[model samples]
Target: MNDKLRSKIIIIALAPIIFILNIITKSYPEFIEKYYSTGLDRPIRQGLSIITGVFPFSAAEFLIITLVIILVISFIVLFIKIVKGGFIKQLINILAFASSLYIIFMIFWGFNYNRISFDKIANLKIEKSSKEDLYKLCESLIARANTLRSKVYENPKGVMTIQGGYKDVFKREASGYEAASKIYPELGGKYGPPKRILLSEKMSYTGITGIYMPYTGEPNVNINVTDYMLPATAAHEMAHQRGFAREDEANYIAYVTCSMHPDNDFQYSGVMLAVIYSMNALADNDMESYKHLAKTYSEGVRRDLVYDSEYWQKYKGKTEKITNQVNNTYLKSNGQKDGVQSYGRMVDLLLAEYKKK
Candidate 1:
């Protein structure tokens, strides 16, 4: 009966309205592509990105930390109230807040899941490749990675290191998008630089290298990831900013942008991304061929890969398994039917582009 209760009911009511709109968007991809993705969403994304970009730290990261703390405090208070026999009121307050997040997510980023796919936007045909095709793709990536490895700076341990550390990496990553956007204008807009997470080391345990915060239009990267993979990972998150919502498509864009980059470090990281994917696909089909081609890796490239393996090995366990399960469900609900496996679909994009060249 109070104004607060009435407002919560009104906000919760919008959930169904938004759900209907979500269905409409999903049903009409062309409509969302024309009206939302390339139209209204551009300014929204760019504006939020510009505002957030001014800050040196990750606004989204800090916001998440704050929210988690608040949530814990809320549950504690709710429990104490329940012990005193107050429950329904607290429950309604939580539900109302949840409904608001759902609304915001749909307005800012959820509709993007319905936009025209990157393959169509880029005019590339994705087809299943033969084993030989996979083998050829892996071979080309390995060769490129080897050549670029010699060009980048490496630590005394022989592992790759960014020329200017993370600051330089963040400063320079946009250049890759600038170069690639010329060829594929769909990913053309400039937004904020990627923000390095203060909790990056902790995030590594969940196996997430980079993540895009759609609400703020910010690309967040885990600096704890190996340097050999960092630039490409940054580009991957940026692709989400350009409206490539699918993991596979974002990955393909990362490769395109990285290859177009002038710096050898960016190009090398990009090639390594492709190499790992193509080689994994090849191994899945023909382990003998994968083993044979991997032997051709340069000593520097091999050392970097080994370090990358070791860096991630320590993070594999129950935490990663649970995280992967949750991510799989999230991706599936958002139209990635293959779930986490959709990431490997980037190989199809690579093979398609390879055929064109």
Candidate 2:
């Protein structure tokens, strides 16, 4: 074979090797947990994040835009090639590119899927939470949320608001993570602060609050979301940046990080997130008790929850459903077999922590 063809064949061969390695790692979580999470992933993610953090704008966002443009142009070119009867050569090129991208993705951040779970690392007792435990968790979260909401700024209508706006929240987010690191030093270290997406409004329509771009090691947040959610969402993405791969773990990290924040707004937001998840679980299992607990929310908490509901209400559409499905598929492909439902698993961590305390 010619050198170019030989190179293409080698690239294609390497993809399966990486796939096999991924399977092996999944089967040996203990080894991946010990060696990859503790020994390798942290340092690599930290280094990438530091390098990317130097830029004021998001390198990940830029990369995404560029990739989309490249894909579009490549498809146009491929169409023209097919018309000219060069289909086989173009197909080979596409396969090689796919293989290279897969390898790069795994090396950078995808391997975290194979690392130890946060529950294991945190030593959380992640048993199925009982209805009573769920209600108690909701009650605790509600009380804390009520107290924190009072200390935070409010809109003229008496709903909680971030005093300075989303940009300010982004700047302040690191302090939350820093406070959290006191408890889990693994999440410590300087990394890129969360970036505000320029297309945040578009992101809101898709029902995505935040995303961690593993390629650039940047956490990007949708600033257009309700102020009550911005802090927790930012912390959640930051957890992913810190190498916690599971959506539920990221959510729990965000809750802990924001709850520990000195700012009441963040604390309120964090507790409110916990309340939402816990209450939803309760609603699923014990409708009467959930309704009773829901009615007990302080006026301030109720108003904020209503405002949050209305904010999301405006964005529900086919686009949101499609985006959610895509995200669900992506999560499942990465071993989150429950897919989007895996996010609800954050309640398990919350319940375990509350029970411990």
Candidate 3:
């Protein structure tokens, strides 16, 4: 066989190898956690983050744009060659390329999905919390958020604003994890700061706050989001960068890390995120209670919340809907059975932490 054919065969063979590795990971979470997530993955993640962090822009964004261009060009080429033979060969080549990506993903970051659950790692008891527990959590968070909002810098409109903006936010993101790591060593580690997407306004249309690029170990934030939530969004993406792959767990980590951060803006942003989740949970359990609790938000806090809601209202359309569905499917495929609802599930972790306090 020719060298090209041999290479094609080798790439095709990777399919079964990926299958076996997936099974192994699924069946042995402890082994994967010890060896893969904590062991082999560290240098790979750190190395990618260090290399990509040098560039001021989002390397992942550039790579994604480049890949899209390549795909469009490839499709045009295939269409031009439609009258010719070898369609089967081209199809096989496409499949091989896809398999190669999956293999690369497994090597880099996908295996973290199978790592031991964050609850187990953090030694927190996540039991089914009651309405009372949820209400208390909301009450505490709302009061805390109100106080922090008063202290944080605000825009003329009274909306909570990051003082130094994205530049300062990115610089401060690591400090939260630094403080949190003292108590939860699992969260401790040096990683690259998140990069702001150049096309952040476009990213807002998809209703995504932030994204973690596993291939590059970069936390990417949509800078278009309201300022009140930006710090927490950065924390959330950084949680994924830390190898906590589950959405709910990452959300919980974000809150905890932000709570630990020194700056009032970061602290307020984190507490506000927890308050929103807790209030939503309370609303589901008791609307009257939620209404009463909502009234407790301080003037400045209420102002920021109102403006944040309005900001998102402008992006409500088909793009956001489709993105939610796609996001749900993606989460489910990664073992998050509750999918989008898993985000709300962070309230459970919040309540657990509250009870401890």
Error of 3 at 354 (Å): 1.1
Q: Write the per-residue lDDT of candidate 1 for residues 1-357, one digit (tens) a residue.
A: 999999999999999899888877788989999899888888888888999999999999988888788778778878988888778888778779879888987777778989987778878777766888888888888989999999999999999998678888899999998887787877888688899999999999999888888778899999998888889999999998877788888888898899999999999999998998889888888999989998999999999999998878999889889999999898888887532232266888888788878
Worst 10 residues of 3 by lDDT: 336-345
Off by over 4 Å in 2: 338-344
Error of 2 at 326 (Å): 1.0
The superposed Cα distance between candidate 3 and the true structure at residue 71, in angstroms, equals 2.3
Instruction: Estimate candidate 1's alpha-carbon lDDT, on a 0 to 1 scale.
Output: 0.86
**Candidate 3: tens digits of C-alpha lDDT, residues 35-137:** 9888999778888999999999999999889877877776666666676867667666666776777788778888888998777777767777677777888
Per-model lDDT = 0.86, 0.84, 0.85
> What is the per-residue lDDT of model 2 for residues 1-357, given as tens digits with 9 covering 90 to 100?
799988998999999999999988898878876787766777788888889888988888889898888778777778999889887777778779789889888877778888877777777777766678888888888888778877888889988887789879988999988887887887888787888898889888899988898788899988888888889999999999987888888888989999889988888888988999888888888999999999889888999899889878989999999999999999888888532232257887888888988
Q: Candidate 3, residue 247: CA error in Å?
A: 1.3
TM-score against native, each model: 0.95, 0.95, 0.95
How much is the lDDT of residue 179 in candidate 3?
96
Q: Pairing residues by index, what is the TM-score of model 3?
A: 0.95
Q: Worst 10-residue stretch by lDDT in candidate 1? A: 336-345
> lDDT score, residue 249, model 3?
87
Q: How many residue pairs clash in each candidate?
A: 0, 0, 0
Relative to the true structure, candidate 2 has a C-alpha RMSD (angstroms) of 2.0
